[model samples]
Target: MVVERKEEGKEQLIQRPVYYISEALIESKQRYPHYQKLVYAVLRAQRRLAPYFHEHPIKVVASTPLANIIRNRDATGRIDKWAVELGVHNITYESRHAIKSQALADFLADWEEAQQPSSQADLRHWTLHFDGSKNLEGAGAGVVLTSPKGDVVRYVLQLRFEPCTNNMAEYEALLHGMRIAKEMGATRLRCLGDSDLVASQTSGTCDATDANMIAYKRAVDQAGASFAGHIVE
Candidate 1:
């Protein structure tokens, strides 16, 4: 979705950026065709032309039931997150009965077939390894997810915050690692980490007594629940 200007009954394009779906986004179990398009449109527009959106009014012309899908009662997880992010923009959606402009027609045609990579789908169990380390310099975390076909994804996250405890850093690492695994369509996950307390709490083996720990525990649980099978050690 690009910002357009109407001049003398002509719709002029402002900014157009091509958005390609990453492997992580393509494999996300929670993504649907419609949801993916809507999210991409809103997020791409926001990222590229945020200042313009803040200063001007924008109208989204679409024939699809985009409003209904985002506002659906069953919407949760990433869909909910995207909707909340889009709420800040002053935009309205109107159904266009016809495509009067040639530019809009072309744009729609290109966007329609954007993210369909191929027909083959991969189904395999994935292993996720995460660890959080803190030292005098700083605190950071790393995670690696290895698929059955040997496609390994390694993510290194540096945690920057003053007055942060070691346990808090461990929880943050687990939360981020689980999110990556979920996005990559890991239905069956074997989670490995050195933080025994964090892993045990997330797996429901140990109780979370601290307020911060309780909140982190809930976040990890929600992320893991999307998977069919999940084990932490």
Candidate 2:
């Protein structure tokens, strides 16, 4: 497994190689199903890079429907065990495409192997942007959800509950946006928000000390776990 840090360049995004891990498969293991091997690779990488996986959302770029296979309701035995083990981390999968970086390309050249193409249903990736504000007038929130097909849905809400803080409103917006996206059948979602605190709290990078904040973070985690792939940024 290889990890790269993405940086915006003058005209394009640059992928800087950061970490790499490799394991040789035994004879019996090498004969496992293609999807199982992919999942095992991911699990091995996560085990070795627990800190990175815990702090940031890791995107697994592959040509297969790894997320669907692992998250399937009918998954059993070892697959179910892999799902449970991987459920604790924030992970998302994207379709593999052209590699622009020479270093990355070289690193992945030998690792590339043909796999079954992902289905259209498994290729759907949604983008969600949410914001919340508290002013003397009142507290309200807004969310914008964009489908994979470029369709957009906008939502606005006014918080009627008393004693709402800006942070609370931020959590409310994020939670509300996630709920709406799930209802709309979004399984792979990328969440964007202006509140650094909210994002950090939800991603488990920052500690939520307040009771309300802790409760809100818990709710967000639960809501996020329902999706096959999701990231909060």
Candidate 3:
């Protein structure tokens, strides 16, 4: 596949694709007893996701609605307390997932359009992005797909990389985004990446595929299965 510096997707890269773990909002109950139960439940999930959370390092962002719990109450304490019971050390993590763009609905619509089979309607296009961050280092990936206007989109995830290479990170960002978009029912997709290796691997233009790329390749292939048309740029 010839590499071209083209922007064919519907959404321009006002911001490049970034795939990094972000904070999640944990709703709490007003009743103290129920609140304890909810806190413990969240802690259980935290424990299951702990290793990834620690390595990828996304800060756990949680909140108790002020109406349910008083501001004076140690909300963070709830997590900390249960974490202790669950054997999670109070460690550093990223806390930004709780904040996401309001464009999720719009983005999902575009993904659905690209996912339909080539039968009646014209093939459509959409763009997906991923950014992976660790400390001062980071990488980004992007893809475009179309899906139904009302469907919720999902993607694959890469938990961690020990030494962390930029190229792999870049590729994973794209793979991860593709997985989610496909899961969300995207039909047609154009995978995008700033990294030549990532684009090449997906486009079959690069023979430099490595062992680490196997899983990502599978996700990309599977994501593309739903799409009647797809591309990479």
Candidate 4:
């Protein structure tokens, strides 16, 4: 049986920068940059374009739900100005075309939970390793489902284009991973991810929109029904 996760107050946002990104330090301090991921690319893009203050370090804009930004690329393959979102929203993008590292992280967390370990034998203690090597900009999730009954579903997928939004990819990966889980004969399951919002959302603690989640949720529902017994969280 599947139960909805409890709805709590808005949670803090989680951020993870993309891997191997070489960008300016701050105030044009390129040489002395933060070696590891510190500020999110989206936020950085936003600050670079325009600076503003916010109540939360991470802001989840309350838009019309499937809202998006568009920018044209120059000959150098660089975006000029962000289409940008206007007022009247709980979530705000500091970056012009960014979905934010926190949002992506949330989705990953949810995805991981939905795929928890499915067996009790040698396969029960396994874990999925997501390729956060790309940091917040991009990520790849790889899950190997194994059962005492000689079942296996190895899923490895990567998503590119931070401008398109990593949250969308996270959900896409979840749907893909779930489909793979079914293919591998996983009756019982255990999933894992560092993302927190995603885990809660799948549990029904939070609601996601089209760009962040639409097809993925539908797939999840359909798969849940097919199983004599299944769970999502």
Best by lDDT: 2
TM-score of 4: 0.37
In candidate 1, what are the lDDT values of residues 1-233, reduced to their tens digit? 44345556556544443322221222233345775666556654664466766877777667887677666768886567666767787877777798645654566667556533343333445788888878898998888888767888888888988766788888777778778877876666777788878866764445689998888887876676676556667
By lDDT, the candidates rank as 2, 1, 3, 4
Residues 49-101 of candidate 3 have per-residue lDDT tens digits of: 55654554333334543223322345565544444544434433233446444
Q: Residue 38's C-alpha lDDT in candidate 2?
A: 88
Question: Could you give the C-alpha RMSD of every candidate to the true structure, in order shown?
Answer: 10.4, 18.5, 18.2, 17.3
Lowest lDDT sum, 10 consecutive residues, model 2, at: 109-118
Model 1 lowest lDDT segment of ten: 19-28
Model 2 misplaced regions, further than 4 Å: 1-118
lDDT of 2 at 143: 98
TM-score of each: 0.46, 0.51, 0.37, 0.37
Q: Summarize candidate 2's per-residue lDDT along 118-144 as a digit string, tens digits.
A: 567546668999999999999999999
Instruction: Give the alpha-carbon lDDT of every model.
Output: 0.68, 0.80, 0.49, 0.43
Off by over 4 Å in 3: 1-122, 133-159
After TM-score superposition, what is the CA distance of residue 100 in candidate 1 from its true location, in Å?
59
Q: Model 1 reaches what TM-score against the true structure?
A: 0.46
In model 2, the clashing pairs are none
Candidate achieving higher TM-score, 1 or 4 = 1
